[model samples]
Target: MELKSNWSKTGRISQNLLALTLLLLPLVFLLLVVLLPLWTMLQQTDPESYHMVWQDDFMRRQLGWTTIQAGISTFITLLLGVPVAWFITRIQFRGREWVLRLIMLPFVMPTLVAAMGILALFGAQGMLWRGWDDTPYLLLYGNVFFNLPVMVRAAYQGLCQVPANRLYAAQTLGANIWQRFVRVEWPQMRPWLSGAMCLVFIYCFSGFGLALLLGGERYGTLEVQIYQLIAYELDMAQAGVLVVWALSITLIAGLLYAVISKRTTFKATVQVLPPKTPSAGQKLGLALALVLLLLCCAMPILALGWRAISAGSSWQVLLEEDTWQALFNTIRFTVLAMALALLLGFCHAALAHRWAWVRSITFLPFMASPVCVSFGLLLCYPDYTASLSMLIATYALLAYPFITKDVLAAWDSLPVQYEQAARTLGAKNWQVLLFVTLPLLRPALQRGLALAAATCVGEFAATLFLSRPEWQTLTTLIYHYLGIAGQDNYDRAMVLTLILMLVAILIFSLLEWCTARKEKSLC
Candidate 1:
């Protein structure tokens, strides 16, 4: 008995040590990577700079347009995504699952790829429309293309939470389909969908790549303006003020999203009704969904492929030594950043399981724009801004939250009894975690890793800001081509964008396959 007590005491000490390590590591990383840099940025800013920045008419217009464009995008996305989500969730049809999967394609697509797709279809030399010169329209289309999936997925998840029994009860009370939805479904979905709309607004408002590419000289948002101020004007004070304003706007949106998201609940066992075949009238609604999906999701990718095939001599860009070096850099940086993200995320999730507040730290990156993060890095680590380490660390900071969020969700859903049983069997804390927790956590880790990998690969704004000429990634390469004049360079940029898209897709597929293989092994 004394031996067992001593062993348990030793185990407790070791477990405490492990917990402290996990807790401190991620916090330290955040302190250096996010907090300290942001603090430095704040220190460099004052009311005088803010006043000077706001005095500029261009700055004020950009801020107003940023808000206006985000509002428009959110309204349009909700207008399209909700009905489509309702159609997919409430009505059964052929290829329904395929449509659901198709929505996810946009989530994996890089912003640069989406921009290329739009330019291919609607630019001055566009395949479909040759005279579409309205930059705001182009920017709006890009925003919808990227954000509609978020709204659709959110609505679908929300709609699933509506109890079928309640709907049936409403129907029995003589409520029509519309009436039933208004009375029984809308309330359940409102919080979830509202939260998603906030996210869409945040993304659209702070988007850098689309605004930079599509906004031309006139329609750029605060993010693009910040980039221009830093990169072109070399106006750090103005950029810092813009960063403060951008952060303030996004932070408010993020808090609202959090509050709305908290009101939503996922049941351990939801009583979902099997979908029924659509009626003739419902088929019209389904057709609208099909049209929206094609316009918003499929158009960009189809356009990319169409343009890539025609990019004949531009394909020679693939043979350049510079292209090869950029490709190598992209792959190496993604691998390194992904490893760092996994480590940070793993520690974060472990700590978050013990203290719920720890989960909030991961959301900081989401609230702050990538441009802001890069600029902060520039200020805090001036000498290291051009180094590979700074760039990779920036990538990890943005990417790790996906892993943390996924792992935390998995941790939350885990049964406590299994861990308790191991403890009762005289298993040390580390032994239980290694043998029991890690296995169950594998699926979540894989999902997070896939997302983190994709994020690192597609990262553009930070890379653009922090990367030196010698350290150019594929995204930076694409941007370089875009900056140069001539049809050949434009075509080359499209080709490079296609390559980046494929890399992201391949990473997602490989991780997903690993997850499936792991599941099979467990079975």
Candidate 2:
């Protein structure tokens, strides 16, 4: 019996090891394409050169301004985001669905394309620019534009999970609105507030495209410096240091955020929730919420659509065969990215179950500054003519954490007996996966893939590094137009920007419809 138990333990270890190895395969590909080159650059580059870049007064000032801008934007996004979240979740409102979607809009837009839209609205020569001050406040407006919605969604998700009975019971117990909110609502929402603030801070501080387009060489960060050193200065050492330095700062900040943000929940006194039904006041509040959603979403999108239509662009530029080809390229990248993300996500979920060690790695390129990761790839693959293989690899690296985390969450929610029952019924492993596992996981897989495709379509920072002129995708083209100062530059950028955003919205709408149909069928 002892010998049999020892064999069972070894068999279990072997099974877990197999899952871990499979899960790690994609990351290994990333190491070959992304991390290996990074290690080489760091080891080969001279340490002495970093001091030279640091010692320059102008460089130091630029660094200071960059840090200050990012910090300010982070704080502002949090301030604005928390209130919107609180209102949306706690207060009853109309058109809440529209508001939720609007908040997720910026999250889907590629940072560069979003930057173009923001530029058209608020840059030095932007439509809203009045020359009121020498420096435009792109840092603030741009930050709020992208970061606010993110905070809303995260915080709102947290708020929605709270028990409503607690608030109402507090009201019944002679507590005023202020007391009810302070004691019942605020205490429960502490987790989300901390997490959302930390997440928003991480995004703004490490943002690459907004900082680049808005800064106008006036500000430089560890992210921007990574690109400049490679493109302008050709200093691998400085570029390497910047990458390592940015990673360190972000890692430290993330660690601190996670530590501080974790909320301790005691497993006791479960609060029963009442049936949810909105009141007249809630209806009025919802109407106002819908108006706010329209204001936030409609203008920028309408601006882009108008530009695409009446920006004086030639029919050839608008409807040529190349335009069709470019659309194909975009779809191709989107599909491939989703596929890779799904595979990685599935593996991550499986391995995370069996091995605690597997949960430790977070090399999602999207989470970090895309410029840093892509440039690391750029140093190795200079001749990036076609994005087929190179871009797929990059997309997989970036989309991994998002797809994996969501899938893992959904998978863990399921019962283990489902798999075991199939296995006992004369089903081989592959057969079980095909018949039992895949179908059970279909909904989450669909949702994850939709998100991955949307994310890949808007990706530009890394593309900026890896894209060559010959086969440059739509996003890189949009970035090129935005960067060049000329007549109709903004106009043309707007044209492509509208196309990209529409593509994402259409895909998102389709997913929503599909999910709705699935729910209705079950009902």
Candidate 3:
């Protein structure tokens, strides 16, 4: 018994040391990679840069248009997303799960790939709008296509919390479907809708690839303009000014979203009836909405696939050595990024679990633009801009918040009884974590890793900002092909887009399958 007590004491010391190390490592990394760089950029920025941006008509217009476009996109998404959410949550239908999953495609797809797919479907040679010159329309379409799912998922989850008994009571009181929804359902869903709109607005506003590709010069967002300033104009001070402005806007929006999200709490468990079958009018409404959503979400992907197959000799591009090298580099970077993300996420989540204040540090990156982050890193370490290590670090840092969020959610969901039981059985803290806690967190870890990998695979802004010509990923290659004039180049870009989509889908599926298998084994 004395020996066991001594062993436990030693284990406690070792575990404390490990926890401290884990906590400090990520904090130091963020300081060096994220905070320090931004500080350096800020110090170097000319105060007059802000004045210049304010005085420039084009800059003011760009800021105005950015907010306008995001607002428009949010409105459109909510307009379309609410009905679909209601259908999925309140009404029964075949293939419902598949439809929900299909909407998630854009979430995993890289922005560059999504942009390319959109171009393929609406560009000069596009089937629907061949020879059209409507850049704003295209940009709006792309934003909606990508951001609609966020609203749909949030609204669906919120609507699911509505009690069936309340609805039944309303029905017995002669309240019609519309009346029940307006009186009982809308109140519960309002907070979620507001939060979702804020999130979608931020996403669309800060979007780099889609704004760059689809918005063109006439319709550039502040993010696109910042990238152009740094990459094309080499105007670091101006970029710094824009970064400050953009970060301020995003931070305010993020704070609003947090406040709204905090108020969206529901009961942990609610007794709800099974979804009701739709009446004929309801059925028709759902069918129409589903079809419209499919066209917006799936048609671009189908068009890309169709173009890849139909464009003869475009397949020959894959035979080139450079193409293969880019593909290999992409996979390598993605794997390394995902691994680093998982490690950092684990450390951050562990620390946050012990001390909730640590969670605030993880959100700092979300408020800053990726373009700004990459450019800040470049400014601080000019010599390492082209380095593979830099690329991996950029991807990992950008994805760290997402991984941390997932892991933290899963950690919070776990019951404390398991750890207590392990402790009662003479298990040390490290042993409890390694054997009891981590095993239970496998599903979340896998999900986080998969998401990080997919994000890295499609990451273009940071990659483009830091990568050298020799270190081009598939995304850069697609950018190159699209910049050149020719049907053949466009077709090749389409093919590469298809490849990226397939790769992302495969990773998502594999991780989900592994998580499912692990859960089944435990059961």
Candidate 4:
């Protein structure tokens, strides 16, 4: 029997209307949160304005710069990230588990905070190399500093599904290492590679804080230009133009990705053998590991903790009344957004389990950028004044893709055998779900929640746009400090950043511990 909630007006209306309402829920939010604002911007523009912005020499030059920088960043991140991802996943190391944790360290930090880490490592005041006296080759280095880990981690996990037996069989057939990989591994992993590349490209294109903080805005991407227009020139028209271009490119890429992703979604059924231990003779591997650790983790720690701490931080920054207020707002928005995301993810996973078409359709919003999402929200609700409630709702809509995709990924991993076993015991569907399936899915649920929280905590771009003056959060506070400008402001930014990160990591760790407890309890 299909259970209907009392909230539905009538049973028949409930049947059709509830389905309609539920179907429209994500759409309504997406429309109001993303599409409406976009339309508003489009409506405000004249064809002439579009032509002017598109034709302006400054805009054109910057657009060219954006393209060139994104291209370089994408290539370099891939070059470095792919190798690191491969090394970590395919080999055993002294601290592989720790390295995985370190890899995830980036996602927890706000983009600005991450850029700060990179800056401390390689900036103008970079402790190791103070001089920016590098050739053209090093231009990509700063962007790649943040982007590489993103690509490597995505690709490594996705590519791990390649069957080891197949690779072994090819090697036994007189194939050398490179030949074996080409013949046996590359074919199956192309989809994951493509997906990883697409993700990396989108991130590099949209990246703002990193380009500003690390690259010093000399190499501006779409995001930097959008910020420059809005903050510096006070020009909405130019901001609108850059935003629309970003939207067009991102949406097109997203649609292509959806088509590609749909094909590989079925490959979820494939399982791999337990990993064989990595062999010795890894001098090359150790060198690589040390370099990555230093660049990604070690330098940042020294820079932020060592230099910034003494330079200006007092207890006043951490305990300021405004700091506490920002913390509260951050927590409130994160929780509210996470709750909505959880609901949407639950519905999508349930629906996708039965229908592939609905699965594909729900995925379109996943590709939408924060700019587009916020723009849509701005349009759909022209009455939308900046309030805590509305901002949280917008954040929720922004988080839906991450929630839905992560949950769906986890859902796809579950086998039907457990449910079948429950059914054979004469359990009904609801009983089977309540007693059997939910328990099995606890880990994925927890993991999704952790990622969602982490994402919300670090989220800056959309929030920056949506935020009213009163809705200051940690990342916003950091931006506020940046706006004030100077060496003195760094400590304030770092203090809030460090606090924000600690909260996120605490939540993630607790969730993980709970997951482990469930496993032991089940065993």
Candidate 5:
């Protein structure tokens, strides 16, 4: 009996050590990559720089504009996304599944590509309209283009959670469609929609590439100003002040999202309603929604293709040594960054399952924009600023949260009995985790990894800030093309943007396919 007790105690000790290791791995990575750099940047900042930034009217206006635009974008996205998501959910139509899948394309698109797409359709040289000016309207359009799908998907998922039986009961009680939605569906969907809006706001507020490319001097966000201060003016102190403000606002928004998400934990319901054939009015509404969605999301991609094709010799750039080198760098960096992100995400998600507070820590990366993160890395590790390791780490920091957030959600939704049953049959903790928990979490892991991969592949701000000339990725190359004069450069930029878009899409598709195959084999 004493020997058995000793064995049990030893097992407990080993389990505690393993748990501690998992907890410390992610925390230490965050400490080294995120916290330490931030601290270093703060230490290097001049105290008077804060006062200078505060006194500057331009800086103050940028801050206000950032907030205002983010608010406006979020409001418009909600208004448009909810109705479209409802239409997609309630009505059966041709190509419905494809529509759902393709809508996510905009969210994963590189900012430069998205910016180019907007320009192709609506800029000064816009193909559709020649009268358009560079305004906040362009920036707003870009924001909606990128974020509308996110809101739609979130609302769709929330709507899916509503039991069909509840809707039936509401209808039987003589509740109209609007009343059914307001009383039965709205309460459930509110949490998901609200959480998605917070994320959209953060993305818009801290966005660097779109603002830099589209928002001219008068309309640029604080992020663009920070880039100007650091890159052009060599004023790290002033940039630090702006970074602090951006971080504070984004941190608050991220925290609100985390709180709302946690408070409204959703479980899978077995009684979801299947899509019904649409009535004549419903069909008309669905048609209108699809047309608007296609125009908003798909036209940008079409415009880019046409622009590239019209450029003629632009396609020839693909054969250049520089183009191939950038492509290789892009792929290599994405692979390395994705590996690190997966490690950090897995550890963080596993730990968060045990302690809910750990989940909030995943939001830390979202608080700082990619440009800010790269700047902090540059300030903190001056020697390593040009190193491949630093560049990969920056990409990982900006991406791992996507994987962590998704996995954490999956963890919350996962049933507990499977693990309990495994343990009852004498399976050890590690065995249960490997054999039981992981298989069930595959779908979430695939989604997270796909997002992480797309993020690393499409990363623009960090690469621009941290990479050397030799380390240029496709995004940086596209930016370079944009900076040069003449029609050839413009054409080259369009062609390269198309290539970059293809790379991102292929990576996402490949990951999804691989995961799907793995699930089939396991089954």
Candidate 6:
């Protein structure tokens, strides 16, 4: 008995050491790749850098405009998204699934492609705003288009958590629709709304591709200004200042989201009743909302497709050697990055399940902007900034947070008995992980890989910052063509956007399939 007790103690010690090692591995990688570089950049920055940026009227205006536009975008998203969320959750509507899918397009669509699609619909030469393009409007349009789904999804999830019994009880107690919503539903939804608002604001404030492509020089955001400083002016100090400023805001917002999300627990899962059929007034409201939402979300993409179809010999553009090379590079980078992300995230999630603080470290990369991350890497590894290896590392670092979140959730949801049962059979830790934990994590890992790959494919800012000429991906090529003059260049850009969209759609379809299968298995 004493010998057995000693053996158990020794096993516990070994497991603790293993857990510590797992946590430290990713933490050290993050330090080297993200925090260390950022520290190096900070060392190079001086008060002069901050003074120079602050004194520059253009920089000041850019900062102001970034905040203003982000606020506007968040407000607009809530306005449009909340009603749609209510409709989707509260009303029985035909084609609801299709509408949800339409809303998801922007989630997987590359920002650069979305920018091109916006231009295709609203540029000076576009279908809607011919000869009169407004940059701010276009930027706002892009922000709303991309972020609306986030708000809607969050709101819908929150609404779904409301207890059907409580709602019906309220109705039976002489509560009207508005009263029930205001008293019960509103309270539950507020936390989700706040969280979504924070996310939308951050996304809009950190707008890089949209601001660069649509806002132009006249309406640069902090992100665009930083890009210009690093890529164009080679002003690391100014870029560093901008990074600090942007990250400070991001950190604060992230903390707020963390607090809100923590407090935003739902009641126990209950059977959700079928939604009521809409009245005529509700029908008119839903129609108006759907039309407006469709126009905002679909018009640009449809317009881009039409432009691609109409552009003569556009199909030949895909045959170009550079285009093919970009495609190859994108695929290669995505595969390598996805693999790295999955490995790191799986380990991180496993450790995080035991030690929750590891999550705080992983979340930093998610909150930090891609441009800032790449800039830090550039400052640290100037010679390797354009290296394929460096690009893969950067993509993996950016994507790992998403993977970690998904995998960690899955890890936490799993019962502890599986591992205990494996141990009871005298299986070792590594064997249990391989034979039990990993197989159970397959669905989450698959989802994470798909999301990470989709993100890597659409990623432009970091890729643009880090890539050499030979390292350019399809997105950078599209940016190249869009910057040049001529109808041919525009056509090529549209065709590339279409191609990227198709790839994203394929990945998303796979994700949906995996999710459906998981749900079926659960049922």
Q: Each candidate: how many clashes?
A: 0, 2, 0, 13, 0, 0
Over the stretch 1-523, how does candidate 2's per-residue lDDT look in tens digits? 9999999999878876886688777567656866676665567567776665478786667556666776787777666666566667765445556666556766776777666766665555466554522353765566677777766776675565567677778889999856876787677666766766666666776887777776566554567766787878987776776676666666665655545433422222345343245568655655665565454534555555655677775324566565666677777777887777777777776766556545545333433567766766666665653356777877777776666655555666667788899989989776787888777666666666666767788777767766556556778777777678875766767777777788987886677567656646645
Give candidate 4's error at residue 133 in angstroms. Answer: 10
> What is candidate 3's lDDT per residue for 1-523, written digit by digit as tens?
9999999999888878877887778888899888889888888788767777668999889888998998999999999999988887777899886776566677778898788778878887786776544569889999988988888888987887788899899999999989999999999889989988888988888899999888987998999988988888998888889888887788888777756755565453566657888999989988988887887788877877888888788988889998998898889889888888888998988887787567656566666778988988988888787788888899999787778876776787687889999999999778998999999888878877777788888889998888888888899998999999998998888888888888888988788779768878988
Cα error, candidate 2, residue 508 (Å): 2.7
Q: Which ten residues in a row have the lowest lDDT in candidate 1?
A: 259-268
Q: 1 or 4: which has the higher TM-score?
A: 1
lDDT by residue for model 1 (84-105), tens: 8999998888888667755767
Q: How many residue pairs in model 3 have overlapping backbones? A: 0
2 or 4: which has the higher TM-score? 4
lDDT of 2 at 493: 71
| Local accuracy of candidate 6 as per-residue lDDT tens digits, 182-268 | 998889889999988987888898868888888976877899888888878988877899898888888887777655655454443
Candidate 1's displacement at residue 218, Å, is 0.8
Model 5, residue pairs in steric clash: none
The Cα local distance difference test for each model comes to: 0.86, 0.66, 0.83, 0.67, 0.88, 0.82
TM-score for all models, in order of appearance: 0.94, 0.84, 0.93, 0.87, 0.95, 0.91
Q: Which stretches of candidate 6 lie over 4 Å from their true place?
A: 1-20, 131-134, 264-268, 410-444
Tally clashes: model 4. 13
Given candidate 3, what's the lDDT at residue 162?
86
Number of backbone clashes in candidate 2? 2
Q: Candidate 6, which ten residues in sequence have the lowest lDDT sum?
A: 261-270
Where model 5 places Cα greater than 4 Å from the true spot, the runs are 1-19, 46-51, 515-523
